[model samples]
Target: MRIRATVATVTAAALSAALAVTALAAPAAGAEQDDTPTQIKNIEVNQNRDYTVVVEAARKVKFPISALVHDPSGIKSVSFSLQHGATEAEVDGRIAQVGPSRCVKVDESWSKCEAVMIADPYTNVRSNALAGAWGINIVAVDGEGNVTREDYMPLARIKRKTHLSLADATPEPVKKGKNLTVKARMIVASWEKHKDVPLIGHQVLLQFRQGASGPFKTLKKVRTDRNGWATATVQATVDGQYRYDFAGTSLTQARSGLADFVDVK
Candidate 1:
């Protein structure tokens, strides 16, 4: 039951550009599979102070990770510490033990690891609470070098604070006989101010479903092309729980950040 994920070759330069203006990095030399996963940044919280650090997995390998330090049945223990710029990083997460087959036990690929520590050597499992926003360089080491070599989470991309005026989305409750309508907008800053954020030009698809608990339905999908706006309409159903999902990009549809929950009538 080891989960294997396809590694896509995304240029680090592309991600660097998404960050604040900086000199572009030459793509690491290698075929897609040979290259390591990009170092994702946790810099949005504090540009110069406390921040979260995320170490990415190899494109070819899938491993379950604990945000903190606890042994999940199927993943191995992975840990690291960082010190960069003005900040010092102390992480405390346990890696899920991977069986010999090395499949991905965890369903999702990206997560804010839960293991926390006021210091790095011990257990401090609060996956989301971060102490300081200081930026720094990180080095991650794992036992299975065959599957995952060491990786880094960059310090430059941290956002000291979130934009209060950024736009968000919500979906109408789906009915047994009716459809659903998905909506999007920029509530924080003007359409122009959000240019740096990737959600703006994204061609989005709205997805929803409800049932006893099984394969969910793909209710609807659409594109966001008009002035920093997108919308979708779908027939709603009489399911007890309703969830609105985004189409393509991973970061767009968050129940907290980009998605919505609605109760059916």
Candidate 2:
């Protein structure tokens, strides 16, 4: 009976030591689980130009986020409803959510997500959706429920299409002292119509070059009319080329290609 009692006491002590070790380990495991720092890397957007978001991580992010992501399903949640400049109210309906199928494992520690954003004029546009600066809010959740979030990503929405052309020039070959009439047209995308339309009341520069390999000199600044056309008159003094340059706006910039040469007698 004395030997049996000693054996039972030893077993109880061992069990208590095992329970103490497990209690000490529980907090450590929880700390490791919460220490994950999931982050966005190599974030890029195809905005005015295809560029990496290196400057502010918030500036010039292209609208419609899905267009930039590789896998749309990887992104857990995203929102462009926050208007930094515009007066549009936050609409939760605009929030985009992606499923697990769109996410792909980059490694054991991280995953890549992708999603798309839709532009709604009534709900998305506050003042002018196009040709304005905006903000985006994002929340990324991994399979382990580890979350990464970023607010106030800068975005610029510019969807303008500009065109400049030297429509007609009087008398292909003319005497040196003769007057030359030049007509040009400028076209830009209409924000309301979603199509190319005339850009009225915009300055168009008429430039002239003395020779084939000479630098262009601005001869005149003409403004487009209701028809998006500008006309200028100049004296034919030398055999050279003529082109039109449309000074871009906050929305778009355009320049005419090399115009056909005009030979002066």
Candidate 3:
């Protein structure tokens, strides 16, 4: 009976130690299974010109990240970084910090977040780092500490102010019903170099005002030649002011200045 009692005591002690180890290991296994990978989908970037990503002048740029977080604890935050290259560390000073802004919950497991990036004209024009291909980084985190990150390269370009000039209408004093010539020139920013160059193949509108205080009416449209010069001919009817309007493009803004006056006898 004494030997049997000692054997029973040893078996009980071994069972207790095994139970303690199993209890500790169970939580770790559960943790591994609970970690569900987050999914990112339907990402977009824009600079306020429809879906175009080109940036000209100072404007509010937007980056939207759509994601489906699989963790049961829900999403915690979403962060964005705008940089010149693929990675943040590749371009240090050029990177713009976009906020871990509030994500709008679309459904139980899906959300969308937007980050507004400010493009400063002066800062971008001066920095060579901002002129080329730029990228955005999106990071999403869940309450359970699971993280998902994605990278995208959005085509972008920095623009400069264009110079437009309308020369005085040739033949200042002209007879009624005679054709009068309107001439103008446009100078646009060059992306390849720092200097501005003559803008070619752009449409320029010729507008005429009946009198000094009257509204201007569109007379005709003329395309600029290789020399950045546009010419249009209109029949002189009365004393009026003439000007050229250059409609903007994806890379530049529309421009018009003071009009040139002409007298008809």
* lDDT to native, each model: 0.31, 0.51, 0.60
- Model 3 misses residue 50 by how many Å? 4.9
TM-score of each: 0.29, 0.61, 0.52
Worst 10 residues of 3 by lDDT: 1-10
The ten-residue window of minimal lDDT in model 1 covers: 54-63
User: Residue 122 deviation, candidate 2, in Å?
Assistant: 11
lDDT of 3 by residue, 100-207 (tens): 566777788777766655555445334434555555555556654444455555434333456789555878799999989989888775534555678889998899
* Clash totals, every prediction: 47, 8, 0
TM-score of 1: 0.29
Best by lDDT: 3
Clashes of 1: 47
lDDT of 3: 0.60
Q: Mind giving the per-residue lDDT tens digits that candidate 2 earns over 95-204?
A: 23223224456655455444444343333321233444444544444333333444443453333456677557788888999999888888765445545578789888
- Model 2 residue 243 lDDT? 79
In model 1, which runs have C-alpha deviations exceeding 4 angstroms?
1-176, 186-198, 211-217, 240-243, 246-265
